[model samples]
Target: MSEPLSVSERDGHCSLVLTRPARGNSLSADLVEAMHEALDSAERSGVRLLSIEGDGRNFCTGFDLAGLEATADGELLARFVRIEELLARIWAAPFTTLAVAQGRTFGAGADLFAACSVRLALPDASFSFPGAAFGLVLGTRRLARRIGEDAALSVVTSGAVIDAERAARLGLATGIVQPDELDAVKQRARRDALRLDTHTIAALRQAAGDNPIELDRDLAALVRSAARPGLVQRIIAYRAKAQDKNRTDRAAAPSTFQEGAVR
Candidate 1:
């Protein structure tokens, strides 16, 4: 199998690309492990800027649900806990963290984007936090810190798709940039990241907000949600409902097309 992540460093900037385009760059167990390893390396290297991007089509479609049928509830809960840990690391990173997202950034993928210090979305990108649909509480605090309590509550509860424009307006995304402008955005981010020493950056981040206690609380919340009985069943049911909705939409599309043709 191909590698799940690509990591490269230049100057003071480290770029981590999610390379599993075939799987929508979903966070499988292997991908999550690779991310932790990459982050560890970046931290040791004292990289000033850490940029994350997806290889194709989508930034990430969220957690990998390919083997949901075979996986046990305990395993699923462990996966979510690890994902929450990854998000926490990004949220409190000493170096500046940037996420350039495109296409469908949903669930934990959207949480990953929110964890970054700078979030840039492509014009076609859309975000939805559907973890609530399955009773998962990942990234709630971090997202609220990014936007606001009410806004985060509304989005998570409703599972509404937030377009790039709305994401920027709500402050979930720093900006919307075309593919051509991405390089410039990264360059600017690099400059900002290198402006301060790692120690100062870490200190500033601490002073600005976020603490170990809150991080622990976030992890605890996720664990509590994931530990609920029937997690596997909950996810299975959610996926089934989503699939049914997709089928219904697709079935309606043909009739709408025929109507337009008749007109």
Candidate 2:
């Protein structure tokens, strides 16, 4: 059976799992729609705690770069805006949102975790926010909340992998556990989370209301900035850099040419 985003529930806990393992659970258009729909249903269903995870070893590898290329740039930009909307919806969600991250989490994937109330990382998992690579501007408030301003800027700009221990220490991840023990840790968290009343959950989130909105504005602005000619050129430059990673010899290809890999 084709795996749509998977959802399951028990007690007051509701869980969402990104499925498309063949593509490393990447957030494609379909997955994005599924996420929005899932949020809608979860809210209507009286879920007290919402848990998000990925089906494969990785939490999420990031946007479906291959899919991103096939679609129009305008459409991609619209989706980035929609993500801002989603972040707001997530913050407004009645339930306490929990991100259960394992393996790779980058770009959009990292943003998803940052949107959550609790971020649980597998000890082997890692994250990155390489806006420099794509000429896209990923903001840092979500990241800055976890790490400081300088480290947040460095990681997002440098596009380097931040490992689990460091992520936890930086506050990017609220808790870190060995991969094998992650399921157990998640279970305890979920169980305790379910006991919390909806009012309590709402109150805790209400106290942080402006935080998500500020981050959303920053993310949305960064995305629009990429639409500018200069940033778009940088985006194109990054594409070549990406291609260089795959090539062996120094013989260069056309900078403007699209590769066998479209995304």
Candidate 3:
């Protein structure tokens, strides 16, 4: 059975919610493909604004490391490129893109939020990137541009949970809203976009051009470098350890775990 992504609309805003609640809204190939399809429908529906959020405890925990354990070498390399390609679409979408993040948003999930023009977050939401632990290279160029190279390295190196306030201070989030006010916040996001002159928005989007493509190229190269035969075994081992750690952490105490499976 296919996992359902909840779709809702209010005040010119169309929201796409990741429905997998048991696995922390982790990304799998299926979820990635579903996200693309959702964006396609959003484009067709003339949604003035589009927002993506998680249905459970995490906005996204990261890629499914368990799934990646058996992923083919060819596909491992392809994943980074594909993720970046989708991000480009988000960056280039005609309407305003917003990411209303809750819980932890890591790896591709972090990049997913980065792809959005504006990100609103709850005080409890945290952000991190642990992909390096798995040799999963991220779009570092964008990361550096967003938060400066030195800070970006600190983020990747620390891989610690940074709360929403820090994320907002670092440019990763445009606003920090109370968890209870999410609906109102999302509506306000759309209204802000709606108030903007269309020509200005179009001009800015055009000015941005294909800048993300360069980052995609950079990300692809990083993936290709990491996916070379000799490197993967260590990465796989690291992920194994990390997966165990994630399980341990989650099991030790209840920490807003959600998304058993996307499908």
Candidate 4:
């Protein structure tokens, strides 16, 4: 199997590419660990900017659901805790963090995008936070902070897929750009990231209300949610419902032949 993540560093910038196209770059345990490792490396190297993108059609489809049948509730809770930790790290990072998302960025994947300082979504991108469907309270505060509390509440409760335009309107996405424009965006981000010295950057982050207490509360919420009884069962039921809806939608969709016949 190929490595789930690719990390590259240049100047004071570190880039993390999610390489698990087969898995829709989902946050598997290995992938999450790789990300933490990359973050550690970037911090040690004094990286001023960190950018995250995924290879293939989709950015990330959220948590890896494969082998969930065999995964115990305790194990699932542990995985969620680690994911929350990763998000908290990104949310509180002194350096700038950028996420360029395309295709489906769902659940915790959306949370990851929200954690970034610069969230750039491609025209084809869509986002949904369905962790609430499975009774997971991950990243609620960060998301509310990014957008507004009312908007965040609506999005989280509705579990509706927000297109790139809608995401930008909601302030869930900082900007929307085509794939070709990404390099220029990155250039701008890097420039902005380096505008202040490292020390001043850290100071600005603190001054801008990067609250450790709130982060701790977010983590606590996640732990409380994930530690609930029958977590695996709840997730299983949620996935089943989603799969049923997808099948129903597909069945109701008009096929090419049917459309031609109608015409």
Candidate 5:
């Protein structure tokens, strides 16, 4: 198989693109590992900006459901831990980080977008956080920091879907543009990012005081939740309900169930 992820350097930005189009760019164990390595490489290369995007129809649909079902608990825990660590790294990156989301961005994918310094989306992009339905605590604190506590709570609890417009209004997305304009927007952002020296960027982040001390606690809670006697069974049941709802919604009209693959 070809690489599931790829990274390249441009004028002033390191671009990371998820390459698992056929799989809806889901975050599989290997893909997550590749993402972690890419982020590390971006930081070490001193890139002024790091841009992340998906190469397929959707930005991402969350964690890989098939992998989740197949892996043993020990291996699954390791993957989840690495995923949380990757999110934390992105959240704390000294330089600018941008997530250019298109199509669907859900679940851990939404968490990844939430962790970025700036989130830009195409006009048709949609986002949702569905982990709560599965009792997962991933990225809760960081998301609240990004979009405020009240909105974050509503989002996670309700599994509400938001388009690019509402996403920008709610502070979840920084900006929205037409799909064809994505490259130009990225170039503009790249220029703006390159203008800031590394020290200045670090100083800005420091002054913002966005350091998150509670994320570790949240991760611990997620571990506990996952280890509950019937949590996996609950997850399977929840997925069944979601799938039924999706089918009903699709039959009613077009399905708006873009809330990632917590399924």
Candidate 6:
């Protein structure tokens, strides 16, 4: 099998691409670890900008559903914690981070996109977070920081797909452009990112504020929720609901990817 993720750097810009297109670029443990390594390498290399995108139809459909189903409760909670760590790392990265979202960006995928300093999406791109359905609070603080508490609450609780325009309007996306304009947007981002020295960028981000307390609070809430009795049953029910929605959607029109919760 091919690698689930790939990283390449040029002209002080690093690109991290998700490679599991056939699986809707669903994130696996190995894939997440690859991403962490890529971030480490980019930082070590003094990359001025980091760009994330997926290889094919969907940016990412979220965490691997099969992995979720097979993992024991203890292991699953650890996985969720790891995901939160990854998102936090991305959110706190010193230099500029850009996410090029396209197709179905859902759950933790949306969390990752929201974590980026700059997020661009294709006209057809759509984002949703299904974690609320399972009572997961992993990215609540970071997401609210991006789009405000009201919008964040609405999106997460409703599990409604926010299309490109709505995403930009809500500040979930910096901008939306056509597929043909993607390279130009990336170039602009790289140029602007490179114009600032690393120290200055770090200082600016520091001034923007750090939410360690909020993050800790949200994480504690997640642990509490996951530790509750019948938590596993709740996840099962959430997945069933998503599967039912997927079936209905597919009946109306063909879907290129499988649908499920993040777990």
Q: Say which candidate scores most in lDDT.
A: 1
Better of 1 and 4 by lDDT: 1
Residue range 55-137, candidate 1, lDDT tens digits: 99889889998888899999998988889999999999989999999988988999999999999999999899999998999
lDDT per residue as tens, model 6, 144-196: 89999998888988889899999999999999888888888889899999999
3 against 6, candidate with superior lDDT: 6
For model 2, residues 112-142, the per-residue Cα lDDT tens digits are 8887878998876888786656667654666
- Pick by lDDT: 2 or 5, better one: 5
The Cα error of candidate 1 at residue 117, in Å, is: 0.4
**Native-vs-model 4 lDDT?**
0.88
Task: State the weakest 10-residue window (summed lDDT) of model 2.
Answer: 254-263
Q: CA lDDT of each candidate?
A: 0.90, 0.74, 0.74, 0.88, 0.82, 0.83
* Every model's TM-score: 0.96, 0.83, 0.83, 0.95, 0.91, 0.91
Mark the regions of model 4 whose C-alpha exceeds 4 Å error after superposition: 254-263
Off by over 4 Å in 5: 254-263
**Candidate 1 deviant stretches above 4 angstroms:** 254-263
lDDT of 5 by residue, 34-120 (tens): 988888787788899998899878888887878445556666666778888888888778778999898889888899898898899
Looking at candidate 3, the ten consecutive residues that score lowest on lDDT are 254-263
- Whole-model lDDT, candidate 3? 0.74
Error of 2 at 168 (Å): 1.1
> Which of 3 and 5 is ahead in lDDT?
5
TM-score of candidate 6 on Cα atoms, chains taken together: 0.91
